[model samples]
Each structure stands twice: as C-alpha cells, then as structure tokens.
Target: MTNLDFLLPKSSPTDLRSIVWPRPMTVLVTAPHPDDFDAIGVTLKYLKNQGHDIHALVAETGSGIDKVYGAGMTQEEKRQLRVREQTGSLRFFGLPDQNFRFLNLNNAPDDQVVDDEANRLFLEKLIRQIHPDLLFMPHGNDSNRAHRDMANMMKAIASKVEWPIALLFNSDVKTIGMKKDFYVGFDEADAQWKAQLLRYHDSQHQRNLRDRKYGFDDRVLMLNRKTATELGIREPYAASFEIDIL
Candidate 1:
C-alpha cells in the first residue's frame, strides 16, 4: 500500500466543495513579491474562468532580487524587470493592466523591519476601495519572512475592517507546513497555463537554477500533485487553501 493509503482513510473521501463562493464575486490575490503569484496561479485562473472579477496586488517592488540573485543590476533595474514580468504574466492570465496594483515598498534586509504602518495603510486603502468578497493571500506560516509578514498584515487589516469577506490562505513554496481546508483541482489545460505563467518570471527562474533549488514549474506541479493526492482527488493537480470567514 502507498503512503497516502496509510495517511488517508480506507473509505472513499468526501468531495468537500464547501468553499465554493457564489458566481461573479470579486477576488483580490496578494503577493509579497512579483513571482509569488505562482503559488495561486492555478486557482486564480479557475476563478477568472468562472467570470469572477479578479485583481492582482503585489505589495513589494521586489528590489532585493539583486542581493538574492546576482549583483550585476541595480535595485531599481531589478524592480523594473520584475514589474514588467509581473505585468506580462497577469496579462497572459487575461487580467488587464488596470486590474493590477503595485505598492513600491522597499524590501528590507533580514535583520531589519519594513514600515508596518505604511504597509498597513496601503493594504487598508486597497481593501476599502476594491472591497473584494474573496481574498487570497500567503499562508501565515510561510518560511519566507516577507510572505509571513504580509499574511499577518492582511489578517490584521481584515479584523479592523467591518466588511464581511472570505479569507483564503494559499500555500507558498517556501512554506514548510500547511493546514489545507480545501483543494482546487485543475485540468491539463489549466495546469499547462499555470506552468506557462510561471515562466514569465524569468529572473526568478534563473535564480532558482543558480541557487540549485527546484525549478518553479516542477515545484508548483509537485505541490499541486501532492495536495491532490492527499485530498483523494482523482485528478493529479490542484492548489490547496485554508479558508476563514472574516
């Protein structure tokens, strides 16, 4: 017997479609950096196909790529490149430029902290203006500091707001552990598109190769397959999310 057989029950698993929202709801997906969207690209595409008004919000300029990757380019140049790539990827996913918003906050070093008040205000304003019915953000326990901080900030902002919105936590590649409340399965076509969308983040892909890390395409597909298998899904690809009503 396989590991899944041991972890999961012997009986057939129930199809948990409890998190499916009503049609045509607005969705806002938050990313700490440009390429981070790969974490939820599949689910975002699925929502878009369902005719939901979807928008992408990138919190940081991703200027720190020069430090993590190589040092050939200036921070400004790296930020611009990431922005262009992000725009291209969103466009490919059928989201127009107008639907994308960028908050050009500086990416602080490991020992330093960013301006929390400014970040909070930025997110609060967006939430007030867009008023998304559904919000997708990185899991709070993500290994990446930026992602973790963003998740916390989002939760804090949501708590302060009086609006009724659904919070869905997307699992990050940097996340070591996750508690998934639901899984969104995708067909081969959608999976292919997600892979294609990830390729648009050329700098990130190159950095992964240079650092000897798993390629974005392989990592995402592997995570999806693993999630689907654990959820007892017949299909082999899915994105998992933890849900909360706020």
Candidate 2:
C-alpha cells in the first residue's frame, strides 16, 4: 500500500477548482523545510480558494535534516524519503510539482543560515522572477536559525528591490513568538493536507519532541492548531503574517 494512503484519500473525480479558475492573485510563500507547507497548508488552501495564484518556494531541499535530525537514517535515505513524502503531500494541496520549487540553499553546518553575497544575489533574482503582489515567509520570531535566516533574506530582498508587496509570516513548532497581523481561514481538506505533509518528515517526528508513535505529531499538531487558533477567526487553519510597509 502507498505510505500516505491512510492519511490522504485519492482525488475526487471533480474538484471545486473549475469554479475558482482565473484566480486573481500573485502570491509567493517561502518555506525552510519540505513539510512547512503542511504547517501552513490550511492557509495555502484558503488563498487558493480565494482565487489567489499562489507560488510556493521552499528554500532548501533539506540535506542538513538527515545530518542533524535524521541521525538514524542515512543521508541518502532521509533525502529520498523526504522528497517522496513532500511530493505526495504537495499533490494533496492540488499544487503541481512545478509550484513546489525547491532551492538548493542549506543551513550552515554550524547552524547559521549565512546571508552572504551568493545568498543576496539569489534573493534578488528570485524576487525579480516572482514579482509577487504578496510575499510570505517565516517570521523572525522563529527560534530556528535557518528560518530566521530566510526571513532576513526576505527583508534583504525587499530592501534591494524596494519591494512594496505585503509580507506575511508563518511559524513552525521549533519556531515561536509570532503574532498574527492577518489570517486566512482554511477548511477540513486543508487540515488533512497538513497531516499528510507532516507525515512526510518521518525523521523529524521520530525525536522526543513530538509523539513516540506519531513521532513529531504532538509538536506539529500543537504548532498547527495553536497557530490556526491565534487567527481569531473560525477558519479550520490560518497562515499568519507581519507586514512591513517600507
């Protein structure tokens, strides 16, 4: 049986997209890991549901994860497993593989996500390419260094390009201290998608931080639910952000 079969049901003959085509929006979401899309899956769905043309950008393919979090799994195993899981999870969001852009960036071996010349150049180029009306990234409050690095890079990109679009921030369990300035509500399908995405990173979940059997279930669930509830709206899920008007 397929690994995700129990969590994500097969696609229905007809999805509601026909009614929402020509979705009028330009959005860009940046994530540090494969499943972060899962963490904010609900918010993504809501934006898509609202006819926003969402573009997802995952900063790293996650080679460091196996070294840091997936100690038990070989680098190759962790890499392959994560890619497979992430691919399946993205499909659940109705996002084509192309929408799930994976950049080769990685956290510094010492944990600093360096924002040197190469990083700056890359960010500027990406912004020019996307030219999004709105940009979403992890909040600075996240404790994870990689996430924080990406957030700062977003800031740098905005400064370099004199960016004027709205900037949204989302959080992961390892991340904290984020406040909600805005929120997008999600439905049941979004929640299911999140579960499936979180399920992809079997390595991260296996640690003591999450649940034993479910592995990272507790951590992922706590972060997912709490973030959604913080929205103060009745959406099944929420993606929170702090905007910079400069």
Candidate 3:
C-alpha cells in the first residue's frame, strides 16, 4: 500500500570507503568471516602472482574464535587463537598486516545486517580510505541473508565511488550454488597453501563430536574439486569465484 511506489529507483545508496585505494590496480577482497578468503585461496594467490595488489577486509568477528567458529573451547581462548591463525594466514598470502581490516560486527544471535546509518557510515569511511579499483564482495544471489546484505551494501555504495570496480564471489558461498562463470588456476603448492590457511580455525574444527550434534572439520575438498573441474583439471584443492564486472 503506497503512493507512487514505482517512482523510486531500484537501488539504494552507500558512501563507500575513502579515495585512497590502490591506483586502480590494487584489489580488495571482502570476506564475511576470518578464514573465508580460504574459499578463494588459490585464485587469490594466482592474482597476487600476476602482480595485482590484493587487499582483504573481514566484515564481522566474535569476541573469541571459539564461539565464533562453533568451537567447544572457551570464547576468550578461541578468540586469541583465531586472531593468531588468521594473522599467520594473512602473512602467508603476502598481504600487509594493516590491510586486514576487521569490522567486528556481531552475528548468530541476530544474523540480519540491516542497512542503517551506522553501517553506511562505517562502509563509507572504509570506501573513502580504500578507494579500491575493484572489490570482491558477497554475491547478491547468495542463499545466506548476511551474504546478500554485503552485496547489497556494496551496490548502494557504488554511487559514491568514482573508479570502476569489479566484484567477485567466493566458492564458500552456498546461496548462489556452484557458479559456472569464472575460474582461476594455481599450482599444487598453491592448493597446499590454501589448506594451511583453513587450518587456522583450530577451535572451530575440534568441536568434540561425541557431545556435539554435528561436528567435523571443514574440508576444502569440495572447494578444490569443484574449482578444478571448472579449469579442466583433477586437483584435490582449488578456489573459485563468481565474477560481476561493472
């Protein structure tokens, strides 16, 4: 029930980060979780090898890694451990420590990321600073609402950005299902390195199966086989992304 509802535009607005991003050559990969970049681990490494400046931004985090990753350990201990793990993984990717910006917003209790003023401000300030030539964010068609919100926010912020940026979706995504559009290749060492990255969330994987209803390590097999298949290979590990070049 509305008056002139059709008069409005289809999309919303966001301020985005500052204008200091790389000189249109650098890339920013935004992840919802700490190790999410692992989903696209090999692909990212390939990009890095290709001489692209890569940046990472995590959207939210728990106080400790344990509670954050369905871990059985104490929240305090898990938090410290996850930080150390992600830190190490970040270093392995050759990304500068300062580039891993954590938004630290809460999830689980209430998963919806409402596009309000605060989020807008935070995103705007970030965009103003990063000024990325391209941003790899969540896919709009993602099944997860939180993932969808990330894409929505990016689209809204598109107006404030002057540079033409692109967005790439990760393989860990379930909402959009197996994407068939894009694939990046990597060596066996690259696959090994990606698995090492996923190993950082020690607390998340060791959730005593006896006591928990469903507990097991998060395997990158699916990530690898799927992505490898896309590239006409049979590798045990790989990472993929769905691209939206705009």
Instruction: Name the better of 1 and 3 by lDDT.
Output: 1
Kindly provide the TM-score of model 2 when superposed on the true structure, using C-alpha atoms.
Answer: 0.74
The C-alpha RMSD of each candidate to the native structure, in angstroms, is 6.7, 10.0, 9.1
Q: Which candidate is the best by lDDT?
A: 1
Q: Rank the candidates by lDDT, best first.
A: 1, 2, 3
Cα displacement (angstroms), candidate 1, residue 179, comes to 2.0
At residue 34, what lDDT does model 3 achieve? 65
Candidate 3, 1-246: lDDT as tens digits: 222122122331111211122333577877765666766766667667666678887755543233435447654454456566677778877788887776655444453355566776788678768876567766667676667777777777755666555665665636566454445555667656666776655554454233353322235545466656656644544455554454
lDDT head-to-head 1 vs 2, winner: 1
- Candidate 3 error regions (>4 Å): 1-24, 63-81, 106-115, 208-218, 230-237
Q: Worst 10-residue stretch by lDDT in candidate 3?
A: 12-21
Question: TM-scores for all candidates?
Answer: 0.85, 0.74, 0.72
lDDT of each: 0.72, 0.62, 0.59
How do the residues 108-165 of candidate 1 rate in per-residue lDDT, one tens digit apiece?
7642225488878878898889988778888888677777888888788888877767
TM-score of 1: 0.85
| Pairs of residues at least 3 apart in sequence or in different chains that clash in candidate 1 | none
Clashing pairs in 2: 169-241, 205-216, 211-215
Candidate 2 vs candidate 3: the lDDT winner is: 2
